[model samples]
Target: MRFLVFSLAFCAIFTYCLANRPKHDVSEDNYLELVREIEDEIAKENELKHEAREKDNLEQAREENGQEKAIVGNYDEPPYTDKEISYLQLAREVSDQYMEEIRRENEESENVGARTASDSLRAFSHPSRRTQMLAEENERQDAELETLQMLASGENLRMRNLPDLTAKTVQDDPTCNTKLDCEGKNLNLVDGKEFRTITGTCNNKLNYTWGMAGAQHRRLLPNAYNDGKWKIRKLSVTSRPRKKVFLPSARKISNVVHKTTKPKPENEDSISLGLFYFMQFIDHDLAKTAEGHVRKKKICCKTPTKATKFCLPIVVEESDDQFDKDDCMESRRSFVVYRCNDNVRNQINEITSYLDASMVYGSSEEEEDTLRTKKAGLLKMSTEDFLPISERATSLPCNATDVSTCYEAGDTRANVHPGLLTYHTVFAREHNRIAKELRKVNSGWSDERLYQETRKIVGGEIQHIVYTHMLPVLIQDSVLDQHGVTKEYDYKDSVDASMTAAFSMVYRYHNLMPHKLNLGRLKGDGVETFEQFNQESVFQKPSFVTRDNYDGINEVTLGMIQSQCPYVNRFMNAAARDLLFLDKNGNSFDLVALNIMRGRDWGTPSYTAYRALCGLGIATTWNDLTNTTDQEDIDKMKEVYADVQDVDLWTGVMTEKKLAGSISGATQSCLLAMHFANIKHGDRFWYEGSFSEDQLEEIKKITLARVLCDTLEDITLMRENVFRTNSDWKRCSDIEGKIDFSKWQE
Candidate 1:
């Protein structure tokens, strides 16, 4: 009994030892190695199978041709058959399953000893895991095999193809040249009709390509709709059966879309009053559509009494009846018609689209000739001591109706406001400063060379300020990323950087205009002396800047920074209801009505189309607009339009909620992003292009604040954030943040 019991104990101990031993000693590396071996065996078997099939085909062909068949040579049989290949693939799958099981087991026993051999082996032998692994492995192997076969056979691999990044050339793209090559024999004529005569002589003709000092030529994009031929591209993605159906009456739109309300201050402070004028300066540089000479009679305004003819009467709602009954004009007293460029004879076309600072330098040769001094590349200036003197100076011609009222140089719209005149003066001074510095650096440089170089530098400065300082504040970071607006040094010629209709209309931020302008001076005692002027009084008035020995100009600059801009949504009563540029009788037109009409005149698509274009959800119903607009604004839209699709682009954008971290709504933000992106990416001579490393470095140092300090004579200190006023104003000299111009010394 003792012997039997001892034997039983020994047997039990041996069984325990076997059960605890490591199962097969398998690991991830070992499994991987086994898989590789199986893969090799399968490949070899597949090759042998291919050869066998080919041999059979050859034999069959020979028999059909009645040719004698050669005896087969004695060769070693393939190491693996088709069945063996299948088995090998199965083995690889099993190895994969074992690896997965081992991984799971290792995780389960991480803090403990190794699991029993029986349990591990059982998990590895799981039939379901083996079947799923085999299927996945087969699919992967088939794909890889197909790819390899395609490569070996020299077939085009679709997976290897990528987007072409080469610049498109004129040969391939019809819209690739600078010159407007007309189909007629005479360069000056278009199709039997005389082309618009070039106004200036060719002696100091501007270089159409390089924008040299004497170059007065402005070239349109080769494929631009208005490029000599009247081929205006339709802006709408889909055509409406009745074009007028898509277009709501401008007066009706103004009454609904831009109804005047109490003024609301913007949530954020205006960094600098200069920004308002700066935008205008930039706009002048970009676009100046010719005005129509013929006055077309149209009724734009309608009162409760009757619809009367002005340029077009603005329809007023009862809520917007702030105008005195006696004071209300039946028509727009001052009607300057917009010039037409298309066959329709109603479409307006911009004269200049390049960022060449044409606003300050002058758009045409004749204008440039009048502005240039022909000595030291200096611009003509007013002799009056009190006036600001620079290129694009506000100086009256001797034959002017009122010599006291100054005529603006460069852009025709330069005399739009005194604030814009201030910006023009500052930038013009900056150009002379740069020119003088460059002359000192290179004494042998001619007036032409000096002028062109100075212009280049000024353009660079403008581009830098816009991209670095202004854009970040205007657009959110996410929107910038979404639109790919980040700096790209390489030039992309394929990009058509022309301004779009939507961008032109949405950018009209007239609501930001304050009702009054403040003119103030920083006194010797550190106390500010301020005097307020009405918006109408400052229009086309540069005399205010010259009055009191130019103290008013200094006071105006100080006042601009001191004042806060009103909210963008609430148009001041002055701008929305009673904009200036009136006749002698003091009859005025509604600015909002003009903006809405301009959008229609430009043929911009309705709001819903733009929403779809911008990747936003289309508002089929008022309820669909909830994501982008306020509930009250959506309700207002519903009251105005029967269908959401009929809502105008400007109206929809204006009513939408401001995007997070941005002042404009999503649609406007998207449009701005698209426009700015085109400007940056499309321009070959972009400021951030592959110019000399040193030149680019110098250009980067030019900031708006630094430019202000360099140009402003009396102002010593200024705030770092020019857009907003500081609690305590700092002197320009005291501001440590000025850009170092010394790096530009060459």
Candidate 2:
């Protein structure tokens, strides 16, 4: 009854606030501020309602059982007292059925008749994967609690050394540490959520933070560390009389495997550069590993002993032609933390682990707030219909220039390259385009409601494109069919949606990048190449995407479609292999080297281990690798790795021959299958169920070509399948089944 009373009181308060809204016309920005203020009040009121309900439940339990019970009153509020923290800890250890009962009881107030998947779990006797994961979590927690307590007292981990937590954190504070721990992110999840959260929380009905930002990446196998502690993999085993694996340098592996002299083979499908750039764009959408403090090049490369604990510099042999003797590539370890006091270390995924176009909408609520105009529910953009220009007073982050300054967007890495930034600009336009269309029909909708609804539609379109248009190119149709990755209506609460660390390593398609990026126009007679750039010159350089540049965002966008991807073999172009992310000093990092070393940093199991896991026949010796890997590649692997089991996951993946009708190999195909399959099956609010049948059909009809046509005004022509170079070309006006937002009207 207290819950109902509090809710009624909240309605009265909210109504009064709305009634007191400005009678006089205000500036657009001021109007947005007022709307946000009301939204904040609503969130506060909802939080209070939860606290009151919990308090009521406690009192009721105490009276009936003749005993005291703890309650988390003002649950969502900060500065959680010890008693409240204890209650939260206690809640974690409870049985799944009990948690479901709590959930059912909580929802019974608003949804008495609705049945959830958990309702069926109540009748089951067998343990599930969720239960097993929880058990593993409990075990890890028991072990890691000691380490956390010790670390709390230890005078170590300076602000620079801390893993992904705020610099403001006083390391000794238990409350602060609790918030940083995995599964401890404070998120508000309620039943019947209309749209996915910005941070990817609440995707799982049972586990609110399963794939949320700051959550540890899911692992295919146990981390392989030398000490079984916090060390990068070096030794062959962590057991008795450990033999040093003496792993080959990541650079050496790169030189041997990717620095190919043989003639490069073109993509069999004649895939366009647009699809290659999309590979990068969507990858940014899915996962981003948290980076540690910026590396101090002098400390990391010159003085090893004085370096911060986070520095894990890659050694460049003295014989290397690129630099002086004893030079090392400056690097920092990824930010990691325990699983809420668990003993294991896990790298954090800094973005939402869904195909929800988080790159267009920032991953966190705080980040998202900066990207919105809050007027007519549109995202912030420049007057030129380009992304908003960066100004915290013109301080540059990447290779951005003052004239063609880096534009701010949902993701910071939007400025990494011209092609990637083009996608960001196009998607931001799409959001506003959808918002204005929605407003035309339903002007009565509040700013908040309109924004969320538009966000929902955009997210739906993104998922449809990824599952339908993108995955087929990356994997075989038969593999997708076998895994049911493309199927809708497979939402299972039991499935965990967390991204695997292996997928990050396997999806590095650096080999396909062309050495040069060309801007051209396809006119009546033939194509005219107007401008060109060495791909390295534009690395982290935002100028190429700006209107001032010769080949601006539009030219880059069109050129990418017209330009051909050089090849799809294991060999990387000179730009990617030797000049990627070329710093101001002209020093660049090797993509293949970075990928191989990251596997060590992440502690992903060896290539053979993953092969076994994927049901690809394992190689006990070099001779056994023939069926899975080519003979020539097996010879290369034998040269680099000390043992068959000791090969890096990335190296193994590259050498394996591509499957028939797919760009990926058998193991790569399996991992992608699992990743996409779980992503679809695990999401409680997946696009299919979230939209009406009519709306879903409209979304399905939408294509990347159609989106490009609709957004890029200058792009008069496009291929039906942007991924295929030989696909039939069409005029923008002739593109069929373009999404009509009017069908979305109430």
Candidate 3:
């Protein structure tokens, strides 16, 4: 029963198992088959889900694309800040997309081990491919960030260095017609504008600045204002009278002379009297005009004799029938000789009689006596009278002498007869006397001493030139405003006036002499230190600072020296005297003032506008904290720190090196100066920090006596071989030699 029953049960059980379990293996095969079926179903479901997802992704992509297009279309109208935010958001999205792509690729690489592999699986596993893409992405983002940083920095710099802030501000003068007032509704400050909303004030004197008013005052207006259409309007102004001011005790001496004086004529034998020759080369216009005049006047000249003939001729007629030829000739000769007064006739008659009586066929006592008497009579007469006049009476046809000293000749033309040379000589003498007088008024120097001193160095010719040319430059610059011809503080006009004065003075004196007036030539050999050869040269000896000071303030001094001049950097051949003023020993005091004044407008100590006021000697009031900064005694210090935060040059004081007190005080002074004078940095003086370190060093070296005083040729020869040679070569060949990088993939 067990066998039979077990067989039946076994059969049943086996059949049941066969029906329930996998038939082929009932173990690994069956389980695998089931697993494969389930996998197939799951795959089918997954495929459907993937298709749905793909459709969703396409819709999302389309929506995203539409949004991107809209954003791009409206990009021009969007606010810059909004645009920046949008770009930042796009960058974040891109980063997120890249990170997600990396994760997906990693996941795919892991999944590839369990599934049938494809070429894409290998590509997804390649670390170098992802690395390259990531590197490119990171590089692009880095560049964008760097560009943004640069833009931000540039904007901040632009704000910090407003190019025309001073120009925009109204001059703080009550007399200014464009001055703003907070009275009534004349100004926007009183009208409660969007730019300004002053609710109340004590007679408008203490009104609050708001909106545009505050923005402008604070220099918060962006660079966009550079292109705006705006007009300045005046609400109120003062009618105050202006006062005249004179140059300080420190008068800047000019090299050119200013005035002239004419000397009185003397007799032929006067010891002081001498012939003066003045030469002039006419300008194109004048020469052409003179030439035209000559042509119009029908003036003619012949060679050899080269005699000039005037249009109005003096004629002589001869008639042969009137008298015998010899007799007529004798009568004509007699007429020529005796056509004079009784005194001249008697003198001639006696002179001829003595000569005739003195002549003898042979030696005799009576003839010798007669000859001795005639010689004695000739000796009593003036040398001029005894001598025969030559045909070429005038050395220069145009030259004129004292009429009383010359036998009157009819050859001199009336128009051009008073020679240009003579006129100029007279002009020069007169000019020198006037210039000397002008100099004495303020210089406290004696005229004769000046004349003697001047004479020893430059001849009377050059002295005359100085008076005619150089003196007017100083006078017109110094005194013209007092004479109601101009005004003080008008810099362009002032510079123009000064230069014109200089030019005119140069022109007049230059015309007074025969030699050409070359300013460059005048500066030949430069100025020397010793007084032994102290002549009309412009350069003075160098006033060098102590070696200790030189080392300590090396950078500052160099910058100051170079900044004052423009040519010291670009042109190596600039004259030594021109490095500063006429003097070689640069004016240290003026240099310091210039340094301070230059800072009034730019960089760390920009006080250009301030110095303009101070330069004008205007009284000003500022906050006590600021004003007290200048009180420090800095005579001992050499280094002047131009800190970014400070507005004044702070002398390096051992006790207060950290404090910026001097800066504040100096800034106040400069600001006050600017408000008063309306001076610009480039106009009044050179600012430090304008030059690079290398340029400054080069310029400061100019102060060295040996460097500047040396000839340019010598300097050129010495420095001819010195240069910066770049020797390093780039690895361009290796980089170019690399094969196509993608070839490895093939």
Candidate 2 structure, TM-score to reference: 0.74
lDDT tens readout by residue for model 1, 1-746: 12221222233223332464323323433533433343455456566667566455434533432234411221433222343333323423333443343345444532211222222212211122212233233323332233222222332323211111101100111111235323344122322423212221111122222222211112221222222232222233333556523334444456565666554554474545556667777876765443221111222232423322112233443334434433333333111112222222222223345565766776555666776777776666664323223232212211113345454456655555777777777777778778778777667767876676677678788888877777776678788878878756455656555545566677766766777787767776243636887775565555666667766556777777667666665233454345544334444556665666545444455777788778898667778888888888887766656578767677878887887666678888888887778667766556776346767887886667778777777877655666655445566666543433444444
Per-model TM-score versus the true fold:
0.62, 0.74, 0.14
Off by over 4 Å in 1: 1-249, 269-271, 295-349, 384-401, 523-529, 570-572, 582-584, 726-728, 736-746
Q: In candidate 2, which residue pairs clash?
A: none
Scored by TM-score, the top model is 2
Residue 188, model 2: Cα distance from true site in angstroms: 7.9
TM-score, cand. 3? 0.14
Which candidate, 1 or 2, would have the higher lDDT against the true structure?
A: 2
Clashes of each: 30, 0, 35
lDDT of 3 at 272: 10
C-alpha positional error of residue 591 in candidate 3 after TM-score superposition, expressed in Å? 29
Q: How much does candidate 1 score in TM-score?
A: 0.62
Poorest 10 consecutive residues by lDDT, candidate 2 = 164-173
For residues 1-746, what per-residue lDDT tens digits would candidate 2 score against the true structure? 12222222233333445475433333433533433344354445445555556466445533332232333233453433233322222222222223333345434432211212111111111122222233333322322232222222332322121121111111111111432322323333222235677887666646766777656688878888655645777655322455444678888878777786543556767788888899998888887774443211224556555654446777876445454556566665665555444456667677778778788988888668878988889998875788887653122234433534567776667776888888988899999888999998888877777788888888888888888888888898988988778665678888887878998889888877887887867676334557888887766566676654433877787788877786666688778776666654556677788788888888888998999888877778888777777888888777777788888988888888888887888888888898889888888778888888788888889888888888878777877788887777788888875877778776
Model 2 residue 429 lDDT score: 93
Which stretches of model 2 miss by more than 4 angstroms?
1-193, 237-243, 261-265, 294-298, 321-325, 392-397, 525-528, 547-551
By descending lDDT, how would the candidates be arranged? 2, 1, 3
- Write the residue-wise lDDT of candidate 3 on 510-556 in tens digits: 11111111111111222111211111121111101111332211221
